[model samples]
Target: MEGHCLCGAVRFSAPDAKDIGVCHCGFCRRWGGGPLLATHCGTSVSFTGAERITVYASSGWAERAFCSQCGTHLYYRLLATGEYFIPAGTFESNDMVMTSQIYVDRKPDYYAFANETPMLTEQQVVEQYGFPPEDAKS
Candidate 1:
């Protein structure tokens, strides 16, 4: 999948992108004003105009990045596995399906998705991903 920032200052491609996942964690919500709709791009992403990207260490095990020029939310990366969960909107268009959701317990009650995806609570995520309990910051 190919994508670019709002201002076209940073472009990227994830050759292995297949599906999208939702993250309802507080950090993700705050980062983009709502839950994150992203794709697990593994570590096969390539970039152009890298200098326009800015990264933030969101937590001990992961970081978030965006385009400096337009502040377009980019990707959330796991430091341990070098995996990248890029925002779904970053791509121009796609056929990727949303199959899973994380931090379901933390999702607010005001809105809900119609998709019947498999959802994982924050605790379940910690256990499944082997993430430190204290690393709930994400």
Candidate 2:
């Protein structure tokens, strides 16, 4: 899959994507003004114009990056496994499929998705990931 930053300053390619996941975690929701639709591109992503990207440590295990020029959210990357969960909208095509959602309990009642994907609550995400609950923080 091919994608680019909002200002075209950074371009990236993922050899393949496993699945798309929605993160309803408060941090994710606030980061992009809503849930983050992320595509799981496992550790094979390459980048061009890498110098223009700025990374912020969103959690102990992951960092979220964005293009400095345009403030476009780039990717949410796992620190240990190097796996990438990129924002789906950054891609040039809409081929990724949503399979699951995390922090479902954190999602507000004002909006809902009709996709009927399997959802996990904040506690469930922490259990499944076996990580600290920082990602579930509001």
TM-score of each: 0.94, 0.93
lDDT of 2 at 135: 42
Model 2 gets an lDDT of 0.88
How do the residues 1-138 of candidate 1 rate in per-residue lDDT, one tens digit apiece? 899889999999987566889988888898999999999888999999999989999888999999999999988999999998889888977777889999999999988999999999988998998876544445
In model 1, the runs with Cα more than 4 Å from the true position are 134-138
Q: What is the alpha-carbon lDDT for the whole of candidate 1? A: 0.89
10 residues in a row with least lDDT, candidate 1: 129-138
lDDT of each: 0.89, 0.88
